[model samples]
Target: MGKIKVTQVRSNIKRPQDQKRTLEALGLNGIGQEVEHEATPSILGMVKKVEHLVSVEEA
Candidate 1:
């Protein structure tokens, strides 16, 4: 599978608990933090859940 870079671009403050947890699952703890992961179905779904708070790009 291809790899994708996920970068946290927005704060999680005031966000719903699920969204915050989603970000944490992606290993994002702060704005500008970046993590790369395989483009698996589960990872993609997690990204979708918090898409507004992150930026994704091919890696």
Candidate 2:
């Protein structure tokens, strides 16, 4: 599997609870915080949900 970097790019204050939890699951606590994870289907799905709140990069 390949790895990807997920960076929180926006605040979760106005976002849904699921998205906020998704960010936490991705290890993001605030804007600019980043976490590298394997590009598994499940992980990708989570990313997709909060796509607007984050920036993804190849890792």
Candidate 3:
């Protein structure tokens, strides 16, 4: 299976609660934080939820 590298490129502070939670759920705690995860429906959902705050690349 392919994997994805998700990087938090923007700050989540002052954002909606749901967006903040989405970032946390993706294992991103702060800006510049990166997490490697298998490309799956759940992760894709979370990424979509916070697409403005993160950048994703195939890993």
TM-score of each: 0.99, 0.95, 0.95
lDDT of 3 by residue, 1-59 (tens): 68999999999989999898889888999899999999999888899889989999999
Off by over 4 Å in 1: none
Please tell me which predicted candidate would have the highest TM-score against the true structure.
1
Ranking by lDDT: 1, 2, 3
lDDT of each: 0.98, 0.94, 0.93
Residues 2-59, candidate 1, lDDT per residue (tens digit)?
9999999999999999999999999999999999999999999999999999999999
TM-score of structure candidate 3? 0.95
| Per-structure clash totals for the candidates | 0, 0, 0
lDDT, residue 59, candidate 3: 98
- Which of the two candidates, 1 or 3, achieves a greater lDDT against the reference? 1
Ten contiguous residues minimizing lDDT sum, candidate 3: 17-26
Give residue 54's error in model 3 in angstroms.
0.3
- Where does candidate 3 clash, by residue pair? none
Sort every candidate by TM-score, greatest first: 1, 2, 3
Tens digit of lDDT per residue, candidate 2, span 1-59? 99999999889998889989999988899999989999999999999999999999999
Looking at model 1, which ten-residue stretch has the lowest summed lDDT?
Answer: 20-29
